[model samples]
Every structure is written in structure tokens, then in C-alpha cells.
Target: MRVLITGATGYVGQAVAVALAGAGHEVHALTRDPGSDRARALEDFGVRPLRGRLADRAELSGMLAGADAVVHTAFDPHDPVGADRALFGALADVGGRRHLVYTTGCSVYGEHAHAVLTPRTPVDGGNLRARLEAELRSAGLPHTVLRPGMVHGGDARSSIVGDWFREARSSGPVHRGRRDKVWSWIHVEDLARAYTAVLRAPEEHDGRAYLLADARPVAPLAVVEAAARAAGRTDALAFAPVEDEKPVYRVFDRDEVIDSSAARDALGWTPQESDVLAALPASFRQWSAART
Candidate 1:
């Protein structure tokens, strides 16, 4: 099948494109700068790199022409509305037969407090999830909405976990928030695999939203300590409540995990034990090499 992936320059999109191309699917990717190092990486992976942004109507319409499915992973973290609207519009033009899988964050469900978020779990996103979901349903296009938990790896600035890890190193020992607060995270590769699985699925999931995560919720304090251990920092870690943390990470300083049984049952998806802190073997190797 021919697939077009948005945010091909992003961590999730790049991994998805690589996975798709490796499986012998014709993969096309959209990027803002086809000449970027990230774009070049996509090209090296055999992804047909298309030069364009999501809002570019001319490029978007043309790109959608022969695509059997589209993975819309390109979302603006700041203002998702524009990208969401533009991408949905483009999908509508592609007709209803093609599957349009839209990527959303589990953050839309907001902080889960002490509960797990299943597909059937009640969601509260201050209308954020509702608006986007409404758009997905009314798109007049075949669609699957995916809400992935904290994506583990990306560019340095892109990885919130990486930031916390880096800060933990400088702050002496490790500083964490709500050691008991649970966390639901997904490895970039596993999330990518889930995306690919959905793309290839039969007529079971349509206009359905899925929460992508592993079996259990990870505690924030444990994660920071584990990450410290992973990075070879055996210092004692400090635990603080969300209220005391800086703006740097106070928002993400809560507990949330998703129930991916729907994804597992529907798409035959099973995530390996790739913890967020443990999933960055490649990045660790690169970081080590750069120092040498």
C-alpha cells in the first residue's frame, strides 16, 4: 500500500516511515525543508521526501492523490488547531474510502490522576479532545484517531524525558515530582509499529480512537531514578510535588497511563518492555560517540 506520512521529520513520523518502507510499502513523506538533515535521513530510509507544509493546499491535495492511507503525525505542539484543521481538510478531499489516521496525544485526556485511560475511559481535555474528535468524526473520511502516551525519544529539545534527565544530572542526585504519581509512556518505535499496524488493519476500526501504551503505569520518581541509573548516574534522587517544580516541567509533573487493550486486541499490537528511559539506546550511543 502507498502511504503518506506527515511530520516525516519528526521522531514518530521518521520511525513510522522507516518501518513502512522496510515492510516494502511505498512511503511518501511531507516536510517543510526537504534539504534538512532530518529530511535527508528520511530520504536515506527510501521514503519519497515531498517538499511541503501541511497548510499548503496545492501540495497537500496533490500528495493525497494516490495514497492508500495517510498518517497525520504533524501537529504543532503550540497551536494544534491550524494543523489539525488543514490536515483534516486535506483528508476530506481524498475521498472517504482511504483511511486517514490522525495522531493525537493522550495529554488531551489531561492528567489521569490515579485512573487508567482505555478507549472507553472517560476523557476530559477542556474541550480540546472533543473538538478534534468531532472533526475526525465529521470529516467525511475514513479515520482512526490515535492518542499515544508520552513519546519517549525525539530530537533533544523534543524529548521531555531527555530534558528531565539532563536536568537531573545538573541538579545533583535526581529531582523528581510525586514519586508515586503514575506515568504512561510509549517507545517511539512501539508507537510507530502501532501506527503501521492500524494502517494495514482490515475493516474493524473506523472513526475509532485508541490509547497507545504498555501494560503498567510507571511512577515518575522511579523513572527518574531508572533514567539516572541508565545514564550511569547513581546519585540519590529528590522527590518534589508538582506544585513545587519549575515551569520547565510542572505540567507534565502528574500521573497518567493509557489502556491499550483496544489497540492490542484490534490491531494485534503488543509492546515490548521498552521503558521510556530504557528505549534510548541509539541516542545514548550517539551521545557517547559525540563526546569521544
Candidate 2:
């Protein structure tokens, strides 16, 4: 299949491109800088980068032409009104030419995450990304929405995890919010695989939205301490108040450990996130090497 990916230069996008290439698919990635190392790497993986912004409708239409499918992995969570409708509408014009996979996060499930969210969870999201996801669903195009959990992977600096790790270790004590709560995490590579799996599943998977996550619920402090262990550091670990005005950390205050049974049974998606801490040695090494 010829797959075009938006945000192909991003963390998940790069991983997804690699996964797709490994599966014997021709990949096209969208990027602004056609000369960056990331773009070069995507090309090395045999991914052709479509140079443009998602906000440009003409570029989008041109990119979508002759494409077998598209994974809309691009979006500005902070500025949804500026770009979403343009990208989604342009693809909707494809008249169902191929699969359209839009990547959205699991925060749409809100803080009431203790309940299992199959393709059937009620829609409620606090952020722009999740709001746009719900709006995109209303377009009635051939789409599959992937709402992933708190993302954890080998790339140490790719996400908010870095701040958590640094703060917990630097603060010398880890304080978790909602103390006895649960949160689902998915390895990046694993989530990328899920993207491809959903794209190839039976048509039954269409118009269906699914959450992508592993089966474990590790608290923030536990994750931090795990990173500490992987880094050979021991600091006090405690649970902090949710009201700490550690406001930036508020983006991850919910306790959601989900069930991906729908994705597992439907697409044979079984995530290998059992020993997340084990990813630390490699993650730490990568960050260290990059710093030096």
C-alpha cells in the first residue's frame, strides 16, 4: 500500500513510518524541512516526504492524489482552529479513496477513566486535540480514530516524561497525584504498530474509534523511580497534591489504565509494555549521547 503520513517528522510519525516500511509498504511522509536529519532518515526508510504545511489545502489535495491511504498524524493541539478543518476536509474530498487514520489522544475519555473504553466510550475531551477528533468524526468520511494512552517509549526526550523524570530526580522526592490512581501507557513503537494494524484490518474496523494502550497502570512516581533505577539513582518518592500548580504537569492529572481488548481482538494488537522500566537504560543512554 502507498501510505501518506502527516506529521511524519514527529516522534510517533517517524516510528510509524519505520513500522510501515518494515511491513512492506511504500510510505510518504509530510515535512516542512526537506533537508533535516529526520527528513533524511524518513527518506532512508524509503519514505517520500511531501514538502508543505497541512494548512495549505492545495498542497494537501495534491499530496492526497494517487495516494493509497493517509494517516493524519499531524495536528497543532495548541492551535486547532488554525489547521484541522483544512486537513480533514481535504481528505474528506478524497471520496473514500482509501483509509484515513487520524491520530487523537485518549484524554477524550476524561478523568472517569477507570471504566473500560472500547469503541463505545462517550465522547468528552478537555483539550483541543480531542475536541477536533470528535469534530472530525462528524464529517462522515472513511476514518479510524486512534486515541492513544500516555505514551512511553525508548525516546527519552520525545515527551512530557522527561520533565517528570527530571523533576522527580531533581526534587529528590517523587510525589504522585491522585495517589492511588491508574494510568495506561503505550510504548511508541507499539502504538505505531497499532496504527498499521488498524489500517489493514477488515472493513469492520472502519468508522470505529479505539484506544491504544498497554495493560499496566503505573503511577507517575513509580515511573520516575523506575527511570531512577535504570539510571542507578535513588531519591525519595512521594505523592504530591493534584493542586500543586505544577500546572504544566496538569496535562496528565487523570488516572486512566485502559483495556484495549477491542483493538487486541479486532486487529490482533497485543502490546508488550510489561517491563517499561527496562526501556530506561537505552533511553538514558540516548539522552546522554545527545547531550554530549
Candidate 3:
């Protein structure tokens, strides 16, 4: 199958492209800058790099011409509804019920305090997740939606959790919220595999949603501590809640859990990395090495 992956040079998109290409599928990697180092890196893994932005209708339509499926991961979170609708309209006019898979975050369930979240949970009205959800639904295609949890890994690049780990190394301590919130987490590789599984079996997942979280949730303090231990800064670590309103800390300042059993049962997807806490230290160490 020929699959066109938008944002193919991005963190998640690159991982997904690699997985699909490795599985013997032809991958069309759409990116804004074909001359970029990231785009060239995709070529190393046998991905066909194509230059196009999401806003370009002619380019997107031409790219979709020969694609058997499209995984739309390229999105502007603040203003995605317009682009999403345009893509959906184009696909509809193109005259094939091609499998369209859209990616959203698990935050749409929004602060799952007491109740566990599933695909069936009602979404919050006034959050980024809700707006994204509304856009996906309005697309009017039998699109498969994947809601991944706090995606970490990739050596502290483009990951909030990875950033925290790096910050702990440089700043001596990392801040967490006052609450002992347990966040659902997913490694970039694992999340990429989920996309591959869906692409392979799109017929079974049209108009369906899946949560791609690891089997367990980790505490914020635990992750910071892991990074500290990895850097051999056991004495240099101090954990405290953020008193001031820093934007990045807000996402980690909440509690949420996800039920990814639907994804597991439906797509035969099973996450191999069950020990996130154990893995965090090494990830941070590698990230530090890359910088210096």
C-alpha cells in the first residue's frame, strides 16, 4: 500500500513513516521543506520525501491522487478546523473511500479525575482537545482518530516530558504541580507502531477512535527523579510545585488515565515498553549527550 504521511519530517510523523516503510509499504513523506535535514533523514530510511504544506490545496490534492491511505498528522492546534474541512472535502471529491486517520491528544478527555477514560467518554467543551475533536468530526469522512497520551522520548526533542528531563539536568530541579497526578504516557516509537497497525487494518477502524497510551501512568516527581538519578545528581534534585504561571508546566499539572484496550484488541497492538520510569533516566542521559 502507498501511504502519504503529512508532517513526515516531524517527530511523530518521522517515526510513523519509518515504521510503515520498514513494514514494506511505499511511504510518501509530505513536508514543508524538502531540503531540510529532517526531510533528508527520512530519505535515509527509504521514505520518498515530497514538499508540500497542509494549506496548499493543489499540492495536497496531487499528493492524495495515488495514495491508498493518508495519515493526517500535520496540524496547527489553534486553527485546524479550516484545513481539516478542506482536506475532507478534497478527499470526498477524489471519489474513493480511502482510509483517513487523524491524530489528536488524550487531553480531550480533559482531567479525568475520578473516572477512567475510554473512546466513549464525553469530551470537555473549552479545551484544545475539544476544538480538535470538533474539527475531526466535522471532516465528514470515515476517518480513524488516534488520541495518544503525553508522548515522550525522541531524545528531549519535541517532547514536553523529555524537556522536563533536560531541564532537571541543567536547572538542578524540576517543578511539578501540588497534586500527585498520574499521567498516561506513550513512547514515540510505540505510538508510531499504533499508526502502522491502523494503516494495515483501516477497514476495521473507519470512523472509530483509539487511545494510544502505555499500560501504566507515571507520576511527575518520579520522572524528574529518574532524570536526576540518570545524571548522577541525586543530591542536586529538589521537587516542588510551580507557584507561578509557567505555560509548559500547566499540562503536567493535571491527572489523567487512558484505556487503550480498544486499540490493543482491535489492532492487535501491544505496547512492549512497560517500564517507563526505568527508561526515563537513560533517555535523559542520551538527550544530554546529544546537546554537548
Candidate 4:
């Protein structure tokens, strides 16, 4: 399969690109700077980097034309909804027969009281991610939505794990909401394998959404303490509460326990790194190396 990946330089997208390439797919990545070190690194790994912007419909259409499937992972943190609208419009216009593997996040299932979330779990229709997902479903494209949990490992600098390390180094481990609020987590590499499994048979995944996370649901403070331990700051593991004014923090206050059995059963996807705390030492090393 000829696969095109958006945000190929991003932490998650880069892993997915390499995983697809390793799976023997001809992989191309959409990057803003094809001449950068990251793009060069991807080229070394057999992923061709193409210069393009997600907001550019013509560029996106042209890039979309050459691939058998598109793994849409590009996100504009500044204007996420606007960027996705453009990408989805382009996909609707030119994405004939091409399978779109759209990446959404577990936060879309906002404030759910369910002990474990599945694909069949009702999503918060008012959440921005859920609204965009609804738009994708209405666009009439051949697509699958993947709602990944809090991703860690593999260049952990770009992930929430890095935030823990940085905070631990400065002031100690900080818990944003309640210390007991649990989150579903996945390693970047395992999440990449899930993408490979889905793209291997896109038809099998079309029109369906899957939550991608490890089987274990862990408290944020526990992970933070592990990160502190890995960073040799176990003595400074005292937790502090940061006042975050963002509305998203409210969602973070709730437990995001996810059941990825749907993905495991349907796509033969199994998460190898189920215990995030056990991997914090290596993850801390990766984060430190990324800083230097």
C-alpha cells in the first residue's frame, strides 16, 4: 500500500510513518520543511517527505492523489478545528476510494461515567474533537477514526510524560486535577503498530472508530511519581496543584479509562507496553536525549 501521512514530523505521526514503512508500504509524509533534519531522518527510514500545508486544499488534494491511504494525524494546536475542516473538505473532494485513518483523541468521550470506554461508548457531541469527528462521518468518505489515549514513550519529549519530567526537574511533580483521576495511556510504538494493522486492511476498518490505549488505566499522579523516580527526583516527588484556567482541564479531571478490545479483536492489535510506570526510566532517557 502507498500511504501518505500528515504531520509526519510530529511525535505520533513519525512513529506511524516508520511503522508503515517497516511493514513494506511505500510511505510518504506531508511536512512543512522537507529539508529539515527530521524530514531527512524520515528519508533515511524510507519515508519520502513532501512539502505541504494542511490548510492548503490544493496541496492536500495533490498529495492525497498519490496515496492508497491517508493517515491523518496533522493537527494545528492553534486552529485545530479550522485545519481539520480544510483537510476533510479536500478529502471529500478528491479522496475517491482512498481510505482515511483519522486520529482523534480519547478526550472526545468527555466526562463519561462508564468504567471502561469502547467504540460503542457515546461521545460528547459538544466536545470539539467529537464535533470534528461528526463532520468527518457526515463527509461521506471512506474513513476510520482512532481515538488514542495519552500517548507516552518513543521520544517522550513531545508527550505528556515530558511535561512531568520538566515539572519534576523544576518544582516537583504536579497533579493538575485530582490525584485519583485515571487516564488510559499507550506507548507511541504500540500506537504505531495499531495504525499498521488497520492500514493493512483498510476496508475492514472503514466507517468504524477504535479507541487505542493499553489495557491498564493509571492515575496521573502515579505516573508523575514514576517520572520523578526515573529523573532521580524521588525526594522531590511531592505533588502540587497547578491552576489551569483552560476548559480542557475540566475534562482531565474525569477518569478516561478505555477498552481497546475492539481494536485488538478486529485489527489484531495488541499493546505491548501495558505498564507505563515500568517504562518511565527509558522514557526519561529518551526525553533527556531529546533535550540535548
Task: Assess each prediction's global lDDT (C-alpha) against the native.
Answer: 0.73, 0.73, 0.77, 0.87
TM-scores vs. true structure, each candidate: 0.87, 0.88, 0.90, 0.96
Candidate 3, residues 1-292: lDDT per residue as tens digits? 9998887877688788999899888999888789988899889999999988776676678888898999887776555776766677667767686788888786676544544678888877666657756765676666788998877766656776666666765777665675577778888888889988998878889878898889998876677677667766766555666676754346666766788999999999998876677777667765776577
Model 3: residue 15 alpha-carbon error in angstroms: 1.1
| Model with the higher TM-score, candidate 1 or 4 | 4
Q: Global lDDT for candidate 3?
A: 0.77
The lDDT of model 2 is 0.73
Candidate 1 local lDDT, 237-273, one digit each (tens): 7655556544336445666767788888989999875
- Per-prediction RMSD in angstroms? 2.9, 2.6, 2.4, 1.4
Instruction: List the candidate 4 regions with Cα displacement exceeding 4 Å.
Output: none
Model 2 ranges off by over 4 Å: 113-115, 125-127, 166-176, 243-253
What TM value does model 3 have? 0.90
lDDT of 4 by residue, 1-292 (tens): 8998998898999999999999999999999899988888898889999998888887898888878899988888988987888888887778488999999887787756777889888999998999999998898888999989899997785788988899877877766766778889999999999999998889988899999999888998788888888888857456445467676667556788888898899999899998999989998888788778
Best model per lDDT? 4
- Record all residue pairs in model 2 with backbone atoms less than 3 Å apart, i.e. clashing: 174-238, 175-238, 175-240, 176-239, 176-240
| Candidate 1 ranges beyond 4 A from true positions | 112-114, 153-157, 168-174, 240-253, 274-283, 286-292
Residues forming the 10-long window of minimal summed lDDT in candidate 3: 107-116
**Which residue pairs collide in model 1, if any?**
none
